[model samples]
Target: MPKPATENLIEFLSNIPFFSEVTKSSLKHLTTVLERETFRKNKLVFEKGSVGEYMYIILSGSVKVHEKNHVFGHMHAGECFGEYALIDSNKRSASITTLEETHVLKIYREHFFQLISNDIGFSQGILSVLIKRHRNIDIIQENLASSKKALELANSKLSGLIDGAMDAIIMFDEKFRILLTNPSASVLFENNDVIQRNLLLFLDESSANRIQNLIKNDLNNDQPLSSNYLPDVIKVIGSHETETLNEGTISKWGDNVTSFYTLILRNIQDRLQAEDKIEFLTSQTEYLKEEIKELTSDHGIIAEDKSMKKVLQLVNKVASTNATVLINGETGTGKELVARAIHQLSDRKDKPLIRINCGAIPTNLIESELFGHEKGAFTGATATRKGRFLLADKGTIFLDEIGELPLELQPKLLRVIQEGEFDPVGSSETIKVDVRIIAATHRDLLQHVQDKKFREDLFYRLNVFPITVPPLRDRGNDICLIADHMIAEFSRELNRPINQLSKEDKAALINYNWPGNVRELQNLIERAIIISQNNSISWQSIIPQGGIEQEATTLQTSNTIYTAPELIEIEKANIERALKRTKWKISGENGAAKLLKLPPTTLASRIKALGIERPI
Candidate 1:
């Protein structure tokens, strides 16, 4: 028979470079200690979520490394894994499996732990593994970079330099094409993306002609054109590059020779009028628009309706004042979006805007959730943790569903809002924060105050500049406007090409009384887009509440407008279907209620009244 398989593996191991230098006595011991294990083709050596205790060294055959939605990469012989765990003792990042029958040196961490306890050199070897792997990565990166062309590297380096530079910078190529723009450069151009675009795009005909003439003159003189111009506020918020651009002429033509010049516009209103709010959009709701645009961007209302637009105007007016703003609106009216707009429009845009839904968090944990807790604060408090309020210091804290705050915790929140002081659980020290509060609620706080459930003092503090966002059903023409935007958004997100919504779907949208408001409308649109089999989204594709009953009645009575009360049954049915699809989960915000765009509280109410099972 062949020399034992273990002996053959021992012989193979002696030839590998990383361990080849070991003495014969050490090699024999290492061989004897390592258990030889065979994994057939496609056998799972380790999985992404398992707790690992062994460092595996591939001696024969290869394995694949795969990340979610990423390519399947390979690891060849002499490679090892379960290595990072040795350093931080964290969970595995990805799974590994053999492509063919494989053999590897399985070094159990327990055995290595014993070795480390007894020998200092063995400990050093384990530490050296991480150092060696890091060095190998550096070498591979350098080798790949060395093969890159000088021009490409120069361009990449220039981009990084521009982002870091205080002043804005813009570059143009010899053919008058836009080459690059830094963050500060965007701040100069009305905070818009003009980079990689034609130089002639942003300017009017007169300005373009004037620049053409000036550039032509500069080329004839073989000099650079220098002029002071008003920069757009949009550009300032966009890029933080250099304020001046230098474009040396390569080939200057006669009057307007084939040439490109880099022009730097300065935000003239920066110091004068405070153009921080210039980037605030008052068109369609940005949240819904961004959703349609496949961006997880915040929402805002730039209402033109005299009543609602006043909220926008007020938010802008007090935004720089750094005062607390309490916004009250119905469930789907975009309260958190307003909070974000306030933060962005304030001086603390660079800081976090931590948000918490007071109602969703259990009353027992609310104290620890908002004020943090020390290690051993309670049974599961194994480590010290920072709470939402502490994390939001120096920035803004948006408390959504503020009315749902527990009756007992209400006083502590009142103290924080009024005195800016809070104590972590089981800690004697009171932490003071320089935080701005922006609270929102769909419930009637005045009633809660009367019932002695809410603190009136806190209400008055946050109600400094009260803002009310209009419901989606009340936006008139903006409904169609938002729908078109959402269709485009969901199409891109789902990677589907839904060219347009069917007339029936459009009619249904307009007729349907969106009790959940804008949020509900957006969710329904997304659902239709995701389920649409064709390029066009139709009403039938939308699974409403009450199933066939709702669909038949809604389609039959398409001529009649749906009132909130009338569609109550239909909404209930749709909610049930959503819950079934999600296996009756109310866990993450992506559950049936969230997917339906209904407030979690509101969804819960319907769930109980309808006897829908709660999976928590």
Candidate 2:
């Protein structure tokens, strides 16, 4: 006889998503009538081209989800599957097998259909779920059918992303062909095509043979011998020679069960790029910043083109003069650096060069920051203090975000510039001093002046000389020069002495248009440095989702099923899940620090230093 409904636990079923919205009595009846089945490793829960059978609720353990290409995803407890085949009657879209000897709650097709047909809400919900899955698969299929060479080029580009992949990437056949490779993958194989033929066939019967034998024996068994010769996970720390087995389970599949899935090959490279773009755009999202470590004060500040050189000559001509300078450029084009340079080259370089963001400063306090104040000047005035102008007396004051200044303050600024005198709030005493102002704004101040939003006198005074910084796209070999500088900076910061970018890394950085400008370059390098394991940085470490990766996989997930990008996106999601589960603390006994098997301090520092914002 079938086992009794143990512990009268229909209440537990009532809370499960599959049963949550259903009536409690219905849940009880379903549970009482269900069969509990156990499956062992290598057992096919369902197979490709197989008939529609039962749908399973994984009360415990997990199953591997393998598409035609390979293991595309994994399914864990409480998630339902086989519903696709059950409802559609199509061939099993993907083959699923037990990752371990797992116990599952199996609902036969007849009973499942009966329950669905009997309950309107339950039946509709199940149909909705199937529709979504079917639509997703259809989108993916359409994308694959879109082209031939285009798909390969896209996939090759995606594979190029794995060169310095922090997570170890392995592409192995059910037999012994090592198809997948990381930047470091070449370390052992020397040539990636080494995986084309069987390992024994390609090698001269030494290390490859030994590894092949080990792989063959372990995967052939019914149960994964975790303590024995089973293939484990891999973690990389930027060294050319260090190899490791990372945490998380690696299970096998394919007709004979020779294929395996790993946690090491996360799509972090593309995802990190996406995160940087999102983070960079949202300036206040400061917890995870995207301002890549600038290579040098000189990098990308001045353009080499003659047209750009004309602008620089103008900046230098007014550098020694006391006249105010207005600097303008697209955001992220190093306008701020030009402002600094103007101050450095000026006569007042010896004194303080006070930098204040007129826009960033709150509207309520714009006046207080620009003019010195006495005690009891306002409600929160705790003490007398010198404002930025007072601090910048006998020197230069850089007024960034000048366009954001209210109309009320523009005239006062113009007065201060013309008269060299101003009184603080609630005080009659006036201080007089000589200060040259350098104002920089991404906004068109002239347009503001036209709208009477900016003071014309102030504009005329500040626009005496102008400097326009060039974007990265216009820079020449300076690209490699900057890249070289980044190599040194990142290598030292990461404590890994990466001497050069792989040919691919150099090419991608040079060809791609850096919308974030020098800032984007710096962020990419910072991320690569944090995760890079090579003596030299690899192309894989720096490929981001926004650049070429997006061009290839950007639309892969939405209404379409672009597999690689979609999978990478999913990987990014899982990392967020892991970080959330670990509470953003990558280290410590209960943290990812312990699970990654890294020192708590190391993991904590990495989390902090890398700016990983958990998806909570």
lDDT, candidate 2, 1-616, per-residue tens: 6545553456556655555555655666577557889899867887788887677778778889886558978888767677654456678877888888888877777777788777676666555656776898999888777876688888888877876465455656656555655765455434545445553443343434544555567666634433332243223332233333233233444555345432233324445567656643342232112112211333435355665677678878888998878888655556667777777888888876667666544578879878857789998999766677876778888887678789888878888888999888768988897998888876788999999888888888888777766677677555666767866866766688765666766677777776556665665576566654556445542455343343223332344433435644664555556677866644336866456554332333234324455453
Instruction: Give all candidates' CA lDDT scores.
Output: 0.67, 0.64
Question: Candidate 2, overall lDDT?
Answer: 0.64
Clashes of each: 31, 14
| Cand. 1 Cα-lDDT | 0.67
Best by TM-score: 1
Against the true structure, candidate 1 reaches a TM-score of: 0.45
> Least lDDT summed over 10 consecutive residues: which range in candidate 2?
286-295
Which ranges in model 1 have alpha carbons more than 4 Å from their true place?
1-307, 501-508, 540-585, 588-616
